[model samples]
Target: MNKRLLAIIAAIGATTIYGINHTVAKGIMPHYVQPYGFIILRVLGAAILFWLISPLGPKEKIDPKDYLRMIVCAFLGMGLNMLVFFKGLSLSTPINSAVLITTTPIIVLVLSAVILKEKISSRKILGIGIGLFGALGLILYGSEVRQDAPNIPMGNFLIFLNSIFYGSYLVVVKALITKYHPFTFMKWLFSLGVLICLPFGLEEFMQIEWSSLPFEAYRGIAFVILGTTFCTYLFNIFALTQLKASTLSAFVYVQPLVGIGYAIFTGQDNLTLIKIVAACFVLVGVYLASRKPNRFYQKLK
Candidate 1:
């Protein structure tokens, strides 16, 4: 019941939903909805949900100076991040999306060092090299010609770019979370996200024939909008209040385990030798990059 434990649980819950989303969201796109159109539903749905509950949190107004930072966070965290990721998922395998997203912790580590002035160790630097090597290998050579995945390489690349945007958002939003309630921050963040992303998604959003879609499609869409977008972001924001950005981001290591397992279980994706090997490199790299410095080293210093 302590804050740290709750934060850990929240981070785990968010990552688990995201892991499953690799398959669930992908199932809804290009057929039930295009990638951009799906993002519109996600942002718009989450915005409404957040606004509905905004009154439960303490009443507080954001400082005018913070508006720019909030807008930037909205764009990075929700707008381009979600847009690029869902597009990539539509064009790539669930396992690939899962593995590629593991790079987020590494990106967060680097960003934290640069933006937050967190110290970086040689071990973490080496881990970065190894992780990027695996990610790049997957992007360059993990291509497969499948009915579902049209362009694997490009999709993987976009997913990688999404990690950068998402990682940056985590670091940037750390300051804002301290100043405002999670509900307040999230409602406005998602509201701005609706405005930022609506233009790109409106045409596709309108094309959907809601009544014609099957039940499975509806389930997938609901899971994405409610579980993936609304819940994950809310959980992560609450987690951030009690944990460091780097610490919270490190929990992304859990994604591939849940994602790959669920994907295989549901027959949505299968693991290749290359995928297995690349995943090893990423997991090892993440372990190195995310581990805390030894107390002995600190004492020696």
Candidate 2:
């Protein structure tokens, strides 16, 4: 019970931080630079934060195979995934971006089953069907649903790819995490990520025109560092010690509602009858996907 409580608190904290970051980033993205440029900075910021804040401990040795997997994890988790997401966020509205990314859980389910041999259950299929219907409805009904808006469509699609890469990274890392401390795991992940992202980051950095924007534009980068980049994942790390990833997956969806509330607060968006219905569907889906059939439920009298 205590563990569950702690996990809930951590997940809530993570979601709140993530929610705020989305709002913050939405405000700053177009003001400063392009998505690729923002992501280069975001990942580098996370790299620095993880290194400085991470603790030193006795190291656990692992196979070369594990190290290779960590490299792939870095590419998918930090490098490519972030690049796509930030770019997408820059092009699309924050609400649209958030809604698209919610597909991460579904991706995780499919990837885990194929790669990790985890079984797909009936409840997961039903939850996905319900949630996807709601999400897909919104996508189709969005103000500019046509692909003619290249930036918006591109951004939204990239976020979906972001979900896939992120989900796959989780399955990949699950093998190595038990053998390593979180800090140690992060060290390898970030270090490898820095190199993989260098090619893209370098291109972005070179193309940026520092003179075009005032120093204030850099504020978004800092927000990415402190509010969104560092804090949200730290909250997730805290929760991992207490809860199963499945439970935490459901909690991740809470960020969408958090995002909707942000939009309302900022006057950027208001809850519509349709969106309310969509939110309810997403909530129910997350609830169903997060839970496994309990032994008590199975053995019901």
Candidate 3:
């Protein structure tokens, strides 16, 4: 198959893993393990996996000048991105996390325009406005009292912050992905992540009562480390090699559909009228923001 098709599949695979992770990862937090501690496990585990497989990829040395960019990418993509996300998930509903994550396309669009010097058409600007409005609405008003979710507004805000970090990472990593093998880029990226996150998570990581944890919690942790962190990053990095950052980020549109459906099916979260409406706004905004201007105008013609 063509590289484009393979990239699409990789992006979709990553999105699917992330969608399910909303619930699966959340199931292990604050009780079995706190959010920051879980991040340590994720980064450390993925770092080890990446290192183990790094030998198979082409041996290419990174330019010394690119070291700073790699460190920034690690902080944005793995450290702060995962840290805030899991913390947000621990304090927010699954559906809320799912819906909020769909805004990544919009965030990527804005970041691309600013950092990558990509053009933003009128439609995209309007989409950004509408998308931010929907996201802000959800953050301000989408509260529900639940045992699992302690601070819904704060959680939603943190999740939004994660979108920015993650979106920025996508745009910034594009250049590095072009220069280095995904294995090479990711191994170092995650190694840096371990150091960045270690200070915050070490105390909590030590507090875990591993012997007392149930089987399901162990399964959840394993899935998070193996599937969510390792596989998803690999898939996304591969996808980035063949797709634009915006195009790869656009695949986040599938996340809420998969995440919400799984959450509802598993009895982890439910939808409300406000959530439904906010989701509509965010999805429409994402569609507009990610649509190519030439293609959109061609359809009009």
Q: Runs in model 3 with CA error above 4 Å?
A: 1-11, 237-250, 293-301
What lDDT score belongs to each candidate, Candidate 1 first? 0.86, 0.69, 0.86
Model 2: residue 248 alpha-carbon error in angstroms: 3.8
lDDT of 2 by residue, 1-301 (tens): 5876977897898887776666677776655666666777777777777777666655655578687787888888888898888777776667776666667766666666676576667998787777677666555554453232246656666766788888777777666766777667776677777777778767766677887766656776687777687777777777877776556655666788788778679865555566577667756765575466332211110
Q: Give per-residue CA lDDT, model 3, range 1-301, as digits (tens).
A: 9999999999999999989999998788888999999999999999999999999998888899999999999999999988999999999988899999888777877876776577788998998888888899899999998999999999999999999999888777777866788789888998999999999999999999999999999999999999998888778768877887657656768899999999999999999988998898888887887776333221111
Off by over 4 Å in 1: 1-11, 236-250, 293-301
> Per-residue CA lDDT of candidate 1, range 32-127, in tens?
899999999989999999999999999988899999999999999989999999899899989999998988778877877786577788999999
Error of 3 at 170 (Å): 2.0
Clashes of 2: 1
Clashing pairs in 3: none
Spell out the clash pairs found in candidate 1: none
- lDDT score of model 3? 0.86
Report how far off residue 111 is in candidate 1 (Å): 1.9
